[model samples]
Target: MTDPVRVVLVDDHVLFRTGLEVVLGADPRVEVVGQAADGVAAVEVARAARPDIVILDLRLPGCSGLECCRRIRDELPDTQVLVLTASDAEDDLVAALRAGAGGYLVKDGDPAELVEAVLGLREGRSIVPPDLAARALTDLARFDRQAAAGPIGQLTPREREVLALVALGLRNREIAARLFIAENTAKNHVQRVLTKLGMSSRAEAAAFAVRAGLLSPS
Candidate 1:
């Protein structure tokens, strides 16, 4: 049998966190391995637990959820994060995605969908609410053409290929499989692509690719 997806729940509300714990724990497909009430504890718990997914809130204490997401992702590339919060602002969504969060969901969604999100992130999929997704892309599309073109030109043919895939929302493992290269090689290519492009997150790269005509919006 396959192993249950390990998850760490992070939120400032004790009642909400406990409720999510009960909701997720009832499903055998997931195992809630740890819980944290603030950003600092969130990172520490994630480092110690090394769960398949870190589900957190945006308005966290000590540090913003975006910072925690970045730190955890930087330190543990294999561990994905899902932002579970009440905020549905386009700015927040874009920021979380730029921080390398694998998924973002508003608090009003069904509890079952939250479970599905955890499982999906475990399987290497990016998740965002349908209603807000288009708006986020539009927000990202506002960069000046000169800014986009200069960095786009700096990429090698291979790095460009990697960039295009990242624009298509392919994770490193998926990109490695598609390009017939080692996962670490794909990771390096992605990092180089990001650095050469002067981008912080894959969302920026994806938006740039679309603006550059390397990828079409879905």
Candidate 2:
């Protein structure tokens, strides 16, 4: 039998944190291992708990959630960090992703959606609220497009080709078949593209490709 997904909750509000613990605890597939009201304590608790997922909030006393997320990710590469906050600001979302959060969800999101996100993150999937997805992509592309002067130029010729195919909406398997490379090789190329472009997800990378004219805008 598979083990339940262990999770750590980090939020400043005691009531909110308690409510979340109860909500997530009700899931038979999940087990709440620890909880913290601040970033510093969050990391300490997480390091000790060694949970499969961390439900984090952007606002925290002392260590700011972004730094905490980065530290947690650096220390626990296997643990997925999911940002659960009330803020819908694009900058917050972008910063969270850049800090290595695997998922982002507003607190106003439905309990079912939040539950799905937690499960999805454990399965190695990136999660974002459906309502914010399109805007999030546009925001990420715009931010990177402005901060990065010719970000595509940073990629090798082969990576550029991979990015273009990604923009064309091909999955890794499809990209491998189209490029006549091994599937793992295609995935590596995609990872390289995302790393070089400072993109956390393929959606951001695809948007970057279009913005950079690597893929023709329709």
Candidate 3:
């Protein structure tokens, strides 16, 4: 049998963290190794536990999730960081991605999807909401035009579709439904778009789309 995907969760909300632990623990493919209530504790726990994936919250007491992600990326290069948070603000999402988050998930995401994201990370895939992915591409193009030029204009046709929806503020699952794809597949596209554009967040991508006239004011 394949080894379970080891995971450590870091969030300030005790009830939410506990609930997540219970939910994730029930998955035979996943193993909940440890939990931390704050970013400082999360870093320590992550180091000690050395789980394959770290599920982190963007907001936390003492250090913040972005800082924690940066630390984890720098120190534990082998451990993937997945951000699970309530905040969908473009800035927060981009910041976390730029800081080296392997995946980004909203708090209201289905438990099954969350489990899939953890597993996907182990497979060397990145997971992000579809809307965010679109935005990342749009932003990358804009950043390229403003920063220089050349290859930024070469986004694939699918990336353009994703960016248009991102400017509209749709979520990942919503995008998946619209495109007739699994949520995980949609996330994979978004991660690929972000990485290609050298962007870290959806907000940055949205702004770029607007400037490029890919999305008009609603």
Query: What are the lDDT scores of the predictions, listed in order?
Result: 0.86, 0.82, 0.77
Q: Estimate TM-scores for all models.
A: 0.82, 0.76, 0.68
Q: 104-150, model 1: which lDDT tens digit per residue? A: 89999999999988887776556777677777767767867677687
Candidate 1: misplaced stretches above 4 Å? 170-204
lDDT tens digits, residue span 1-218, model 3: 99999999998888998999998999999999999999899999999999999999988999999999888877897788999999877667667767878778899889999998888767655577877665655444545455432323756778777766655656677678888988887777766766677665454455555556676644
Residue 180 lDDT, candidate 2, scale 0-100: 99
Task: Identify the candidate with maximal lDDT.
Answer: 1
**All candidates in order of lDDT, best leading:** 1, 2, 3
- TM-score of candidate 2 on Cα atoms, chains taken together: 0.76
Across 113-209, the per-residue lDDT of candidate 2 in tens digits comes to 8788888777545576655755666675655555555776788999999988876657788889999999999989988888888766554565557
Best by TM-score: 1
List the RMSD of every prediction in angstroms.
Answer: 2.9, 3.8, 7.4
TM-score-wise, the better of 2 and 3 is 2
Flag clash pairs in model 3. Answer: 94-201, 134-162, 134-163, 135-205
The candidate, 1 or 3, that scores higher on TM-score is 1
Pairs that collide, model 1? none
